[model samples]
Target chain A: MTGAEGKPAPGKEGAAVSGETETAATEVVAGAGAGAEADARVGVEAGAGAGGQAVAGAGAATGVRDRTAADTGAPDELWARLKAYEGRAATVACAGKDPVNAPMIRHWCEAMGDTNPAYEGPDAVAPPTMLQAWTMGGLSGHEGRTDAYDDLLTLLDEAGCTSVVATDCEQEYLRALRPGDEVVFDAVIESVSERKTTRLGTGYFVTTRMDVRVGADLAGTHRFRILKYAPAARRKPRPGRPRPVVNRDNTGFWEGVARHRLLIQRCTGCGTLRHPWLPGCNECGGLDWDTVEASGEGTVHSYVVMHHPPFPAFDPPYAVGLIELTEGVRMVSNVVGVPYDKVRIGLPVRLEFRRYEGAGTGEDPLVLPVFRATEGGA
Target chain B: MAVTADRPVTAAGAELPPLEIPITRTLIVSGAIASRDYQDVHHDAELARRKGSPDIFMNILTTNGLVGRYITDHFGPRAVLRRVAIRLGAPNYPGDTMVLRGTVEQVDGDTATVRVVGANAIGRHVTGTVTVTVPAGGA
Candidate 1:
């Protein structure tokens, strides 16, 4: 039955069918004017008369299409087609593969260094921030992802907007999730913004809204937006010129730069060696300190790749390692000579001095003690 | 009157009492770690500076939690926050205070929408719409 056009069969014949028909009709009404996309674009642009003009010219389709063809470029057709998919399901139908449980919650807490006791023990609830984690398809994706998302992605791909980056996400949690509660969610293509230019590229901001349900109750909504567009003209990575914060207590460490030595501050009173040049020994609160030449050896205690809010001085995804020196203190420094993802924890590294190009002024060159990965890695 | 979560008691344009929260270094870092966000810009000043930020900044999770707290505190024990959609603008930096302000945007049978904005010294730290299910009685 043409649900969109179906009339209610006199006197409630069937409740389910009528409900389905009405919903389908709503979708059809919402998805109206597929053939009048160009005119609608003009209407949106003109903010008034153009859409009325197009609506008036509905019978004069050929004439309007010719004028649109002669006026704007052809990309609007694809944009309009993409817009037609709005309000449609992004995922087919999905459920959390596993119910929310404590073990996963504990692991997430541990990874996040979260000491919040609310997420533990009996009567505990998952962190609201983990709303999306419970819905992830993991290394293997789930069954609910629809073709529209993939098709839209492919369209962007064919248009040379191959690289996709998550711009940002907004999540709303309406209910607390308890362990053993199953999650079900449905995603919709909410809106597609007009093509816009950004530092990254010229692309459309595609937003998908997901309504997460706990049983039949509405629990939350997650709206995620991403840009699907061609890469913009690239800018050169900023040449390193960042000034190291030099101040009391750490000035000696910079002075060691002049001597081509990496100095670790050793508390004279307690003999605790610190790489960061802390003022006092934590063990004894001893302010008296002297230099100990670093043996230039350490292991990667932890590391991260700086990805967002790109900087001029450095490109993103570069590894910054927290190296645990054999001398018993940790120093944060850039890890060079290895791929960023390859810079793993427990990776052995040796300290090396590298002088950055002189900052615009012929001031003393900014020399730094960077760690070079030693042989052997995970 | 103790406004329990079950009392549906609010009207459109009702303003929630403003909350002034301190943004500390520990708040930013611990919040980041709590949210499982290990981005260096959120904790390491040296790294943050190298990345162009003057100092470390707050993570989105902390902002989310703070926003959640703001609404729950107002609605009381029975209100269930059904949705919290927020977008960040200014960074919540340490040594600054973020003041949260909210206006109830809409009130239906048992639900209310609160528009919230958190502002720090520099400017708007975060802004978003929160939809919550109040107890019966049109809060």
Candidate 2:
């Protein structure tokens, strides 16, 4: 029976006690510390740790606390209190805002530039990476979130660890989430790491495990981790432009850039040309390929001026264009020598090699290919 | 459209035709909205700058969607996706381009597993493995 204080009655036994009761009982024992051994013994006897137990048996009895005590600023005590929150519910049976449906799927595919036919038509299922998307509360946020996670964060904030960054997340899909399947999930504070020093600062890593479900069957699990840290002095280093990703298939292209040459892949079998490089030609499925130096004369097939989210290496309000080369291949590059607003489709442009000074970060100077609008073409 | 009758014969070392996606502000914002993720960092540039990002970046779901697209685009319409597991690295900002490349790693009966990596100007945006079932038997 739920007692007046919401804690399970001390002597209750058997499967009748709900998960909420077990969680409440575990919290009480963890807060009361070693003095609650008798209660923990009873908890073990009553099948309390089955679904929602925070810490089992002797584990809960060791981290006793004086809830009314003032801050001691001791790292061990803070860590102990943080560890006590492990296995607590972050959100319980939270319902998705929208069920798996087609309209949203279409929108997602469109934005991602994806035209895979499997995502359309009648049998379409939500994208698997959409595991977390379905759980997001959107503008208003869901009401199913519990206070424990927030309380943990507040405790860290009070301890001078205020800044937060999401490090990474991993997901495993058990089944495809189809339209009309009502998504429901429960999240648990899986663990909290001890204080550690990182490049950003000293902080603790908190990871949460969420099990998403449809009806009573488990569908997938998502584990997310974030680092809560104290702020360090801001470094004034000017960040360099993001480096291009180069791998085996396209290393030749980058090598071309280093030599101030723009190279396009040409199929050895069919003579078809391709841009951005590929291992096999799409037209011939030929594995052997050779490179051809581009003439660099092209017209802007399309363009977009980026004004937001400024980067240190380049000025904003510049035009990035899809240049369709005379050789019949298109590639994306910055369009220069013209105002961002003046750049237009079908504008004639010529390629130029631009050298960028490194940010004194021990990186070599980078030479990249950009397109400049022809005189009077703008 | 008749199920193609014949599917491409898949092998372990087969490579998928690469896809190039121009990262644009429209793609970033629409991807966020479509996924129902209303986080400020995904849609609002000023707020994102205040929070330390240079601009709004692509959400993980969008990255996932692109990866899924890369696989199915190669395996054709009848391809059924079973699993997608990915980890994020570099953020995908507008004015950049992300090129997705995939290789068929294993094929067992109708199910084939592919390794996918999406790289942009900054670095590798996403790396993961996807398992899908493609229709059996073709050239």
Q: Which candidate leads the pack in TM-score?
A: 2
Candidate 2 on B25-81: residue-level lDDT in tens? 998789878766555666777765654556777765667677877776676766767
Give the C-alpha miss distance for residue A132 in model 2, angstroms.
Answer: 2.1
Native RMSD of candidate 2 (Å): 21.5
Candidate 1 residue B116 C-alpha distance from true site, Å: 0.3
Per-residue CA lDDT of model 2 for A1-378, tens digit only, reads 001111111331111111110121111110000111111110101111111111212211111111222223444667789877776666777788888888877777778666665566787777776777777776666666567766786777666566554433456678788888888877777667666543334445566667788887778777655545553334556777778899999999999999989999999999999988999999989999999999989999998989988888778988889999999999999998888899999999999999877777898777889999996555
Model 1 Cα lDDT, one tens digit per residue, A1-378:
111121222331111111000010100110011011122110000001111111111121110121211223334555687676666566644787668889877766654444455566797888665676666654345656666656765665555544332323466676789998998777766665555444334445556666667887666666655444444333433466688899997999998976889888988998887767788898899989998888889999999999997877777889999999898789999998888988999999999999887644566667888999987454
For all the models shown, what interface RMSD does each have? 15.2, 16.0
Best by DockQ: 2
Q: Report residue A114 deviation for candidate 1 (angstroms).
A: 12
Kindly state the number of residue pairs that clash in model 2: 2
Q: Report DockQ per prediction, comma-separated.
A: 0.10, 0.12
